[model samples]
Target: MRSLVFLVLLGAAFALDDEKIVGGYECKPYSQPWQVSLNSGYHFCGGSLVNENWVVSAAHCYMSRIEVRLGEHNIVITEGSEQFIYSDKVIRHPNYNSWTLDSDIMLIKLSKPATLNQYVQPVSLPTGCATAGTNCSVTGWGNTMSSTADSNKLQCLEIPILSNSNCNNSYPGMITNTMFCAGYLEGGKDSCQKGESLSMDRRNKKEEEGKKEEEEEGEKEEEGKKEEEEEGGKKEEEEEGEKEEEGKKEEEEEGKKEEEEEEEEDKEWKYLMKFEQQS
Candidate 1:
């Protein structure tokens, strides 16, 4: 349950570079076809369509007054293609921890399937998490600047994926099996602003050859996550030499961390000095 205005944009460049979720540009209509806005009567969190009848979002933004709006660029005006649907079912992950924000995922089941059109489509769930260098795009109707007020259009930016270890540094002891991190290393653009939505999806191609993975069903998905994590682990040591300064703040905290605790934090941050550092 949150709010926002809309943003206007020119052509899009998918290449990754210096940009801000904080310094993001408002998205033009049709540029992002899979984003959805979760309305809790007023403002809302960002979401993505997994299928015609289901949408996924963060559990931390949960509220009772939930509604799903698709093909929406601005909330104030109603366009012909925009479809408003009520949530028939809301399932926060069984293991979702409110305090730690672990497994921050929720599923919204619409009363009926949304009609597929040019403006509305589902984002493909990768067979596994994206690799370290993948440029994942996050879009939302959050604030244009750092402040709480949102714009009239959706905002989007491409952020490279950071490993679990690097992500854990930002949120002490918070990263989990179901979550992967992506944001500016220096803290610029981010879609999780006040009154904004956190809509995101991976742009990687689906693995058609991996259809056999459907056999194990749930078991296979867990394996895929492990594989992705291991793939990123290859360059962990190289990243540790850098990123030492940015972590000093998180390192300082309020009081001293025990020797054992410091040891663990170091273990997690040994990779992902920056999202684009693989080169």
Candidate 2:
């Protein structure tokens, strides 16, 4: 998906910054492990779930195909995990523009509704379609170190909402009213990196190889089946030829017997005529 690729590029362009936190800013963990696992692929740059029907994340997150695995505590590869839910649909704000990164928000609709537990409850939205400056928490699975995917805990940091005017000045032609900005005012402390691009590249290569192997094997099997059918058909034709030859031989024999009987009858008639003349 173009969106997924775009997101990786975007992360490279904006590496995460580890600068000092603003005075009141604090980072917290999500209460539920399930909440953290569902949004694993994305960095905590900007995203939220609006309701059971929709997960509101950054539009850039949607640019890539994302798997939202619910109910997992950590990010280890495991089978039959209880908190696994895949995203069925993605809806980015209609007005989103990548050049500006404005209207950066998006909504993800799940194929099935999520079960609510204390650890897996929905985050609250600001009342009244709140404007920027309304305090909110940002959570994600971004790497704590540069250019790496971080551990799978639901890491979050609290940020005061910056006014749309201020965000525009910072990102210019890169911010829109439909979106908001957070993090330190200084540039270095807040960023996403290019290293994530490498991880995705590796994954793509593996997938391509798998497909190629599958196709080759399928072709071989099909060829073998065709050969078998041809051999069977030839055997059937040979049997039919033998039957036709036998039928022809029987017909010729029947014709010869009928001719012999006609000859005998003609001879008997001639003898009777001669006897009558003598009398």
Off by over 4 Å in 1: 1-20, 193-279
Look at candidate 2 and tell me the lDDT of residue 3.
12
Candidate 2 per-residue lDDT, tens place, 108-141, comes to 7777777765445555443244345443433345
TM accuracy, model 2: 0.49
**Among all windows of ten consecutive residues in candidate 2, which has the lowest summed lDDT?**
1-10
Please list the C-alpha lDDT of all candidates, in the order they appear. 0.61, 0.48
Each model's number of backbone clashes? 19, 21
| Per-residue alpha-carbon lDDT of candidate 1 for residues 1-279, written as tens digits (9 for 90 to 100) | 111111111001111121225667777786666678778776556677778998777665566557888888876787777988888988887987766555556777898899889888876654444566455566777556545565668776766667667767766664556555666678665645321233223212334324445656657777888887876674564466456644775676533566667777776666545434764
TM-score against truth, every candidate: 0.61, 0.49
Cα deviation at 29, candidate 1, in Å, is 1.1
Question: After best superposition, candidate 2 residue 14: deviation in angstroms?
Answer: 4.7
Give me the overall lDDT of model 1. 0.61
For candidate 1, the per-residue lDDT at 40 reads 74
